[model samples]
Target: MAAPTPIDQITDKVERLLLRHEELQRTNALLVEQVHALQAERDSLKSRLMAARARIDALLERLPGASADERKERT
Candidate 1:
């Protein structure tokens, strides 16, 4: 059998590159989706943290020691 010509080799290479490009695009899309999901999760966690902090602050205000402001000023 005859060996492949230069044009055939170049065509093969181009096809491979196209396949690789498509693969990378798919991977990039998946990564973007993951980033969005993670960002949403992080925002939810931040909201929960803020709520917890508010609850803790309220509890501190109810404490019998000096007022919250006075305690902060002393520290």
Candidate 2:
């Protein structure tokens, strides 16, 4: 059997690199999708937190002797 020539070695390496490049591209796309999903989740959580804070503020306002200045000092 004939041994592989230099050209054959180079071609084989190039093919392997191309395959690796394709695999990396697929992995990068999946990571991007995950980042987008996480960003949306983070935004939703921030909105929920803001709503909860508003409700707490409202409840505090209804409490007796809970003056605006007192609230500011507590914070």
Candidate 3:
């Protein structure tokens, strides 16, 4: 087999680098998509938590006397 010329070596190296760059680009895109999904999930959870807290507050307000003493006695 003939030894590869310098140009051949450079071309091969360039092809490998291009392939690596393309792979990294794909991985970065996937990570970004995952982050977007996670952010949406976090927002949903925050909204749910806020709604539950509001409901609890409303329930507390409806409680008779709305006092720690009444809560302790009920417990």
Candidate 4:
């Protein structure tokens, strides 16, 4: 059996570290993409909510004002 040299061990360690760094970089990019996708979905939902609110307001405006007789009829 032969013992490994110090230089060879250092080289192996450096290679492993570089591989880990690359993996982390790829993971970060994926996370960033996911964040952007979620933000776009949030904006779309907000727009839809605003549009629905406007439609409801318009419908209310078109109807005649409520009267005491209409309120009494409900009961």
Candidate 5:
């Protein structure tokens, strides 16, 4: 069998590089989508946390004999 010419070798290398570039582009797109989903999830969790904190504060305010000084001292 004849060995590959330099041009043939370079062509093969170029093809491989193009395939790698395409694969990396696909992977990057998926990563970006995942990051956006995670960001939305984080925002939802933060809002939920804030709502829960508000409810706790309201409950604490309603507690019998729970003075403002005691709440400040506990924290």
Candidate 6:
């Protein structure tokens, strides 16, 4: 069999590099999308946590004293 030419070796290397580049690009896009999705979910959870904390604060403020007996008597 004849040995491969220099051009063939260069072409094979280029093809492999291009394939690797394409795979990396795809992975980067997927990661970016995941980051955006996670950020949105984090923001939503933060808002919910804030609202829950505010509700708890309001309920505590409405109560008369530290003791449960006072709350029961008031009710």
**lDDT, candidate 5, 1-75, per-residue tens:** 999999999999999999999999999999999999999999999999999988888888888998998876764
Model 2 over residues 1-75: C-alpha lDDT tens digits?
899999999999999999999999999999999999999999999999999999988888888987899987775
The candidate with the higher TM-score, 2 or 6, is: 2
Model 3 whole-model lDDT (C-alpha atoms): 0.89
Where is model 3 more than 4 Å wrong at Cα?
Answer: 67-75
What does each candidate score in C-alpha RMSD?
1.8, 0.8, 3.4, 5.2, 1.0, 5.4
Q: Is 2 or 5 the stronger prediction by TM-score?
A: 2
- In terms of lDDT, the poorest run of 10 residues in model 2 is 66-75
lDDT of 4 by residue, 1-75 (tens): 678799989999999999999999999999999999999999999999999978876665566886656644643
TM-score of 2: 0.94
The most accurate candidate by TM-score is 2
lDDT against the true structure, per candidate, is 0.90, 0.94, 0.89, 0.85, 0.93, 0.87
TM-score of 3: 0.83
- Top candidate on lDDT is 2
Q: Please give the lDDT score for candidate 1.
A: 0.90
TM-score of each: 0.90, 0.94, 0.83, 0.73, 0.93, 0.81
Error of 3 at 49 (Å): 0.5
lDDT by residue (1-75, candidate 1, tens digit) is: 999999999999999999999999999999999999999999999999999988877777777967768856743
In candidate 2, position 47 carries an lDDT of 100
Clashing pairs in 6: none
Ranking by lDDT: 2, 5, 1, 3, 6, 4
Pitting candidate 2 against candidate 4, the one with the higher TM-score is 2
Segments of candidate 2 deviating more than 4 angstroms: none
